[model samples]
Target: MAEAPTDPSHPAAFWDARYAEPGYAYGEEPNAWLVRQSERLPTEGAALVPAAGEGRDAVWLAQRGLRVTAVDLSREGLAKTGRLAASRAVEVETVHADLQDWTWPVEGVDVVALSFVHASPLFRAEMHRRAAGALAPGGLLVIEGFHVGQLVYREVSGGPPRADMLFTADLLREDFAGLEVVELEEAETVLREGIYHDGPAHVVHGVFRKA
Candidate 1:
């Protein structure tokens, strides 16, 4: 967990450089936790995925008959998402924009997937707020991110080094206040996604329904 640069020089540069290389930074498969929660998601509806790098989760949802729109800062990553979606014969609308400034559609989606987004504390709340507001009535919000306890794993965890960026069940509850929480918990799990994220990790998982 290295501290990200304080200067926000289009954070896209940081991610673009990483994604410009061959292979997905977080692997080509959908996150395991997200996969487990997918059973609860609507079979066919619009979904909004923020920080959807390489679009793995978005592609999976699209394949399941959901219309998915994946937003990310990195154009390179979104490009890979396009290729991946094409390979899977699914359609995933890709939007390359900074989450901090991106205008979310008003009650425009049926699901919001926050699979391992790990945004900084400065933007996390706003991001969650927008995600929540973007959801249509009764839409689902699925989240899975490194827990603050993951700090103990240090570099092995491969997430933001700043504790503020890591989450706790309480923090998520607050971030998504107003939503009806159906599931919220923290636990240790093995993550074998890609070269970027693979190890024993402490994480928080949540499922909130827009009231």
Candidate 2:
């Protein structure tokens, strides 16, 4: 059996190697929720996608006529995203930076999209704050990730192992205190990734609008 890749010490390197393969790590399409919510997103506004692995979401947003800036620590991932954007004939700004240390834009982004970005609790809180602070008034923030119950399915440990790393509706509500909670729910979904996440999983999806 292949060993699970869960080393938090060098996530950039791990993900970089994982994405160095021939194709996208999570497929070429965008997340289902993002596609469904595209109508709600502003057509000509800037979007920030932090920890944007392989840039699927960012590229999709760009294709929808949104100016997108995607940041990821992994060079390999950013390269793949750039290639995808070029192939799709969409423009996107790609940045290679670690979210924990990189400076985020202040009060300009119309949307901040975080999809399946797992981090330490402290870092996660900081990320949430940065994402919230980067948004302009009435801007939208979309987040989707696994919840605690996700550990029960498939036994395929791919996400953050610490339960604290998993998100809940209450946690999001608390972290993004001033945002209007447009939608929040816990649901079960199947991730159809290549060799990594391919099974049933419990997750929390949220959409918040800055007040």
Candidate 3:
């Protein structure tokens, strides 16, 4: 495995190289958790997908009749997302910007979908804040990531190796104190993607609604 970048800029380059291939690094399907939680999304509202690797989930949201914006640090990843959106005949806004530094949309979003967005501790907290703040009243925040216990099932194949980068329900609850928890649970599920995350793994999935 490539060493985790000591400098923050190194991660963009790392992800850019990983997404340089012709196809998406994680395939074209929306994550199962996101799919399962789609029913909870508002029908007529804007959706924000941060750290959206290749627009699969964004495209999926667009198909569900929601206006979507997909954001990622890697230009290459955003390019792929645009291509996929075009191919799918879906109109989606693809933004290539670092989540930690990007200017968030001033228009409150109705839903924010954060899937497997593992990053440094500081960035993670900022992302959580931004995600929660982006939502309008009665909006939803859907998140899924490798939990701390996932290390036992999948070793180091998925998510950040630094334990601090991963999430726990307690951390999420603390970060989203203003929101009402709709669903939060940790479960062992089969992650079917490419060679990277193909196995039974532990994950934390949560849905919170702003009051």
TM-score of each: 0.94, 0.94, 0.92
lDDT of the structure predicted as candidate 3: 0.82
Candidate 2 yields a Cα-based lDDT of 0.85
Off by over 4 Å in 3: 1-9, 154-157
Cα-based RMSD of the predictions, in order?
A: 1.8, 1.8, 2.1
Model 1's alpha-carbon lDDT is: 0.87
Range of the 10 consecutive residues with the lowest summed lDDT in candidate 2: 1-10
lDDT of 1 by residue, 128-164 (tens): 8999999999999999998999887646657767788
**lDDT for each of the candidates?**
0.87, 0.85, 0.82
Q: Candidate 2 — number of clashing residue pairs?
A: 0
Cα deviation of 207, candidate 2, in Å: 0.5
Supply candidate 3's per-residue lDDT for 101.
84
Q: Give the per-residue lDDT of model 2 (tens digit) for 1-211.
A: 1224467888887888888877787778887777768778988889999999899999999998889999999999999999999999998899999999999998899999998888788788888999999999989999988888876763662566668888888888888897899999888887765455667778889899998
Please give the distance, in angstroms, between residue 69's alpha carbon in candidate 2 and its true position after superposition: 0.5
